[model samples]
Target: MLFALGFYTLQALHYYSPYFSIFAVIAYGLGISVSADFVCERLKSTRASFMGRNLLTAIGAVAAIVVMVFTIKDTPPTASNANLAGLAQYMRTSTDVPGDFYDYAKKPSYSVMCSWADACKLQYLSQRAMVSSANQEIGIKGIIASERFYQATSEDEALAMLRSLDVKYVVAGGRLTVWHGDISKIGISGANPDKTVRVLKGDELPANKVGQLMAARMVWSSARLASSGVTSPLHHFRLLYISYYDSEKPPLLLYEIVKGARVVVKAKPNSPVAISTNISFNTRRFTAWHDSGTTNEHGVFSTIVPSSSSLVFQLNR
Candidate 1:
């Protein structure tokens, strides 16, 4: 058994042919043992023979000990060493997230939009829901949907897509700030076919494309705050926005805005309900209104109708 173990160890060390080494070692040991037994049997009556046997055994034991020591010393480092102290420190500090930042944990079930890598970390630490994880276990359709949301040309389109997915808060960060020319275009075709599948120069896109992306304002940015003496990691725009576009447009202007720790929207009666929002309203004191049961082309029905003839609802987060 000891010889077999030693043979296996040598094989692991890339010794010449495992089978050959095992056979050779076993044959050599057997030959030595047989020869020693024969000689001992012949010299069984002699004290010198007993001393010689003891001396041989001692030499073999010493050789085994030396081999074991060298084998242990030559062993390579493990893969676990890749995890450094800095990595642990980074993960520990990430959990010290600001309260003012969007907290998806408050909601019963809602998705927070962020890069896949950050999403994985936040999901683990916060125990909150996310749009898609870094592992992409949500499948290809989910990946394509998220890609479309990021690649959206207008706030309306982006909000509409978010509403479709029932997403409330959108997160912006340095990892998300891709240059126009550096954005990947290989996977699925986006809304803009001409620029969809290729990295595009800034000038190549339509005039409104850049403006629409800029409109999603940064409500909180960690890097921006740190520059002004706030101690935090250096990453641009670790901001969370309520994703409101202050435009008198068709889809956006028609919905009732609900902004709290996150944002929620309720479509007016008989108005288009292409957008959806998820905000926690249980803690606040607010009156409930009746719905007219009007459904849009998207099959989204109105939930809250105004009690008074003319009413305006506004909230700050």
Candidate 2:
């Protein structure tokens, strides 16, 4: 009983020392054995008492076996540990991370921008820094900064935000598209095609082009984009792009800007394609693109090669 009481006290105190629990269980079993022996000696003269005690003990043994069986049957496998191991392997093998980015002790020097859960696991398993984790220990400013970085109107803005946070690598996986409830309240709507609106505070959004230009300068001067080189059955690479927003519905007009490169656009089959370009234009200008043609059954379309221009695409209703 004392051992049991101590075990409960330790649990209440949140001291989950496994060795201490084992010792307590052993002491408890000894105490029960001694007590049972004393009781049996006193009741030795009574056959009825002995029979009752033996019957109760047998029932308790059977009940314990039943409970143990049920517990063993219902318990799920430890799949999360396996997943973490796999992630660690992936991070180690990834070519996207530069050699200098492997330094573990330096905070904010090299960190991954990803979902809270992935950030935590990657940080632990990879022994690298992460921008955010399951806990919001980075605080409101960090959260706001991350939001601005993802929803930036241009590459320059996004790069500037990454520089501010000292984030070296951007990781994208299944978690990137997964909808996290209430994330919209924090100005981070997930990659769901239906949820297109992105909100930002005045301070969070860049006030002028000067700051954006500075950010772009920093990116060109310091950082270099690379691929993770991780391949899976579903996709060729685990890390897609450095940007945070979805590829299908790019958040900004800057994303559509391609220089001497083929641009691919996907939409619902047979949807009309509207393409346009203007140097001094924002995302709003894309809405005015002239209708080109209806997409085929594959929902894919190619753009005419352009040298330097601000391009936009919209599906006609």
Candidate 3:
């Protein structure tokens, strides 16, 4: 009774155990001991009391089976440890990092994004200062700041949060149960980003946390979006590595924030031009794209950015 009725937290979401789960061994044993004699004696009779016990136990057993069947994925820390292992190794290795990264112990680099219960597992394996963690090593305010960075729907807000925290690297994955929504899927929330509108501010219409971080820069999902001309491709951040993308391996991705490449374009005088690019990335895949500007009286347009690709320019008609 205590085991089945007591609350159990899975990936930080609290729910009552419904039936005889493996975790309820003690309860099962106790129940069996008490009911075994009752079962034998009741087999000789057809009273309501005996029937009720059998029916209730049958119902509970069924409920437990349903819950267990729906959750084939493993729980926290252990959930995707294999998937996250390679990315964690990359974080710890100095040779694999960009030119800006000195060392985890030596430089304030690599942001371990937070909020999910399983998140700390990655941070623990990375073995560095996470932006925040369930351990609360960075405290409540730090955790809130991390949450905002992940949850913010606006590019400015997300960048603000990153710059504010001096976060250079961002990581994604090891979480399967998304209780919330984020544009980049970097943050966790109860909102589904697909159904919700992405806004530039928390106070904007459809005032709920939807993610835009994935769109702010290139991501594993960006290729499909860019190919379909449905997305504004990655700019401010560069992909470092990703393991088992779009698979059951439960991918782990890493990216470094950078100052993008600057490109100047010559266009009709005083006109706002549209710009796009197809960026080859991580020496593994390609990601899009860049910025735009209005030309001066001289018909010269120039913009500095983090990265770029093949450039195509069109005047805003």
Candidate that scores best on lDDT: 3
lDDT minimum window of 10 residues, candidate 2: 227-236
- Per residue, candidate 1 scores C-alpha lDDT tens digits across 177-209 of 222223433222322333334454452445433
Q: Pick the candidate with the highest TM-score.
A: 3
**Model 3 per-residue lDDT tens digits across residues 1-317:** 54434323321221123242455533444454456447656767557456546765675566545444443332322335555665665666632343233244465444555445446766655555566566533423423455455545555666677776667777654332223332323322333433442333534323132224432223455434544546544456666677653554335667667666656777779988656666554446665554555799988786544452335333333
lDDT of each: 0.38, 0.40, 0.50
Better of 1 and 2 by TM-score: 2
Instruction: State every prediction's TM-score relative to the real structure.
Output: 0.31, 0.32, 0.51
Residue pairs with clashing backbones, model 2:
none
Model 3 misplaced stretches (Cα beyond 4 Å): 1-81, 94-110, 136-143, 173-219, 222-229, 248-250, 270-283, 290-298, 308-317
CA lDDT, candidate 2, residue 140: 40
Clashes of each: 0, 0, 17
Model 2 spans with C-alpha error above 4 angstroms: 1-85, 95-108, 134-144, 174-317
Candidate order (lDDT)? 3, 2, 1
